[model samples]
Target: MTKDKTGRLHVTVRSGRKRKLSSKLWLERQLNDPYVVRAKREGFRSRAAYKLKEIDDKYKLLKPGMAVVDLGAAPGGWSQIAAAKVGAVDRKGRVVAIDLLEMAEIPGVIFAQLDFLDDEAPEKLRAMLGGGADLVMSDMAANTTGHRKTDQLRIVGLVETAAAFACEVLKPGGAFLAKVFQSGAEAELLAQLKRDFTTIRHVKPAASRQDSSERYLLATGFRGQQRP
Candidate 1:
């Protein structure tokens, strides 16, 4: 980072001989991202914390005494925010987290190293929560194959699965939030969400990069409708 003539700060990462150009670019982006610096200063797990905070701030999705579930909560960024907002640290609410990767453990969150698609996930999360949840959020993304259509389908598939699980475990009037791509949900999935939830919308937080295709799907007012 350096200051130029006008005193504006600039950061550029020159590609090293051994470092791939892609890696250098990614590193440069991270270096220039203000949210990354803010997250480090605030002790949040990742810059993604701000993405949830921005959504929840505007939507008021999280509240004290609201049980929440965070799927694919590795590194626990969203889980940390959810725990704080719901007062899980004070035992006012519970946060049950599921991920295939291990997490370092947050005070208000109970974690399990298991795939969310596992047959027993719903029951296990319910038992951990002692009942239904007020919200279920996921930031999970499938490994990209670099094919645009295939990647888009993979993203929507993850959202659909998470939404279905949210319906299964959320109490009536609960909410669901998950990452979706620019393509958004397919017609059939969108129709299913409309049937299950009172409202559905797309959100893009300031923390998300402008050029990125990532967006969030927020569905609120779960009807508790039975799903086959």
Candidate 2:
């Protein structure tokens, strides 16, 4: 580790014979990332906590007494921010998180280990929320297939599924936020959201790596349920 002229600490990773190029690059990025260092200093679960923090700072999507549902919430980074912002610790709000992978307990987050795609998951989450949710957020990403087009399609499919679940569980005039890629395939999803929401916006927070194609779709003021 060494400080550059700008007073920024830089970490260089030496790739061993056993370490793949991708793994070495990823480790180096994590080690030098300011958000990762900040997250550790603040005791957050992961660097992802800063992404949600930056979004909520601008949009005010989280409130003191809202009911929030976090889909694909593993490692509990987003859930931690939601719990604190929504006052879940004092029982003034509710935050329910679900992911296929098991996560360690967060102080005020109600976590369930289950696949969001399962038919039973929606009803179970609704019950846990005690009714409709004020906000539904998803950071789910599908497994990549290496082909760029195929990967984009898979990401769109995952976002569509999360949006459908949000439509079913969000209260009238509630909000939905989900991670999406910048690929052009999002047109269909945006069209659908325009029909269902009063406002929709795409945002790429500073916490998101500049080299990454990731962005977030934020839709607010749902216009009630739509029948197909």
Candidate 3:
């Protein structure tokens, strides 16, 4: 197994029998994925960790003592990275992770079993973080419906909601990152983020599947109605 800068791990899979087209394709891709191999070697939870790690390497958002909130943190890959980047035991450093699915515990992360769409979720996360966040990231995507348009809209909704909550909890000069589909329907959300942030950009992590329509929004420099 080999891990890449993007955090995807590649594994060898025996193609003993001709399987269904999708299964065969998936198996072949996994076998060729370098990041997958690397993650396994490095003891990371998933290749997704490389996505956040690469982003942070370029953006410098994950600081040693920054407070962070992670949405859809199941399996805790992102949380693990956050805990390490933020120095779990360091003063004024912490990570708050939320997901509907149960995640294995990771050191230095506060885990919550709740859906980000839930009405009470935002307040609950803030309570866990003990106040405003320096960064709020969401790798959340709705379970695919196999219907392209529907899946895109659902993911967009999740991104929009995450952005709204980011405005609520982020400190000035904070950053927000959320998964988004590249269907070009995110104009309104992008515009809003630009208004509230100093800069907004779209990023496609190398770990993300090329065939997949997913991308990420990187918004920085929060400028909203301040909440003390």
Candidate 4:
């Protein structure tokens, strides 16, 4: 590791015979990433914690005594930020997180190891929340197949599912946030969101890698009911 001009450590990885070039590059990127280093120092589960933090700082999404649901919340980075902002750690707020993968315990979060797409997921999450949610956020991403169009479709599908779930359990003034790609195919999704939300915007936080095509869709002021 060597210090860059910003005084951040940059790691260089050598590709061994057994290591694939892609894997070596990924490892190097992770090691040199400033947010990864900050996450470690700050004790967050993943570098993604900064992404939510930056978004929340600007949007004021999380508030004390609010109920929050985190879809695909493995590793609990977003959960951590929500818990802190909502005072979940003090038992004044509620946070329910669900994912297909088992996540280790997070202090103020209720973790459910299940797929959000399951028919039983929404009811289970509502029970865990004990009431309607004030905000529903998802950082879920589909497994990439290296085909851009296919991956984009999958991502949009995931976002749509998440939005549907949000509509089922969110309060009248609730908000929804989900990760999405920059593909132009999101027009349909945006149209749907506009029908359901009073305001919708696409945001790319600084914490998101500049080179990455990933962006977030934020929909605020839910219509309180789903349209036909």
Candidate 5:
């Protein structure tokens, strides 16, 4: 680590001989990222917490007593912010997290290690909430295959699935937020959300890397499904 002429500290990865170029660059970025540093200092699980924090701070989507569900919540960074914002600690709210990988326990958060696309996952999450959620959010991303088009499709597909599940499990007037790459492939998903929700928009938090294409798609005021 060395201070630049501007007095900003910089970390350079010197393990190039043992690490692939990609791995070395990623390690150096993680080490120097201000959000990662702050997350460590603040005791959050990961730097992702700031992404959600900045969005919710401006939108005021989270409130005390809101029932929330977090999808793909491994590492539990977003869950930590949601738990505090919704007052989950005192039971003033409920938070249910779903992920294929196991997540350590977090107070006021109900964790179920399962694929959210499983046939029973939606109903199962609703059961855990004892009814419906006021908000459903996901930071899920599909694994990349190194091909840009294929990766874009996977990201959109995952977001589409998460949005569908959110529609099923959220109460009337609820909100949905999920991470999406800035791709035109989401036209169909956006069209569906426009019909199901009263408002839709994209949010990019400062914590997200500036070069990344990621943006959170937010749909609010669900109109509720029709009942026969």
Candidate 6:
């Protein structure tokens, strides 16, 4: 069970006569969600698009003609926004998106269907990009195992792997973005980002559920090979 700002428990066991209650409640919440309504009205693939938008707004990291890689990009919301914002005119701007799930094709973005944890994934991504990236954004979250600590660790591993890949491929002064739950594991990643980047901060977008613990880490000014 999670507690909201009002200090009320927002989740309950779905047992006996309440077996369907939890699912129904979730559906009700999604239907009534303002972000969901806005996403539908605006024809965005998912509400998660606003998360990247807000982060980019604060950090001023996105710009025209930048080479970007989107990790765990499924259903194509972030990729769609990135393709346009990065200036895909005549493919001068490049956006490469990868995920384990099949995604509907978004014009002007390269989509790779592969698990990022696979050893071959990075090579394939670079092959698609034809060079290193200027920005690597990861919304990758491990599939939840229902155990709190295990789930947290799994996501931390995902974030760390993405960050390591970014360090290898991002240009000097590049940016890296990844999703993280507000957990103790974030401290180590934050510390590492601070060491390699000029600035690092956590951001929670308004499009995110107010009750959710999810937040984004924005790291800019990649030290790259210059790190002492």
Per-residue lDDT value at 195 in model 3: 87
Higher-TM-score candidate of 1 and 6: 1
- Candidate 6: residue 58 Cα off by (Å): 2.2
TM-score of each predicted structure versus truth: 0.95, 0.96, 0.87, 0.96, 0.96, 0.86
Error of 5 at 202 (Å): 0.8
Against the correct fold, how does model 5 do in TM-score?
0.96
* lDDT (0 to 1) per candidate: 0.89, 0.92, 0.84, 0.91, 0.92, 0.83
lDDT of 4: 0.91
- The clash count for each model shown is 0, 0, 12, 0, 0, 0
Per-candidate RMSD vs. true structure? 1.8, 1.6, 4.0, 1.7, 1.4, 5.2
**Lowest summed lDDT window (length 10), candidate 4:** 219-228
Query: lDDT tens string, model 1, 93-206?
Result: 899998998899799899999988888888888889998989999999889999988988888888888888888889889999999888744777788899999999989999
> Which pairs in model 6 have colliding backbones?
none
Relative to the true structure, candidate 6 has a C-alpha RMSD (angstroms) of 5.2
* Cα error of candidate 4 at position 177, Å: 0.4
Q: What lDDT score goes with residue 184 in model 4?
A: 80
lDDT of 1: 0.89
lDDT of 2 by residue, 1-228 (tens): 788789998999998999999999999989998999999999999888899999999999999999999999999899999999999999899999998899999988999999888988888988898888999998878999899999999999999889988888888899999999999798899988998899999999999999999999999999976221
Cα displacement (angstroms), candidate 3, residue 69, comes to: 0.4
Which 10-residue window of candidate 2 scores lowest in summed lDDT? 219-228
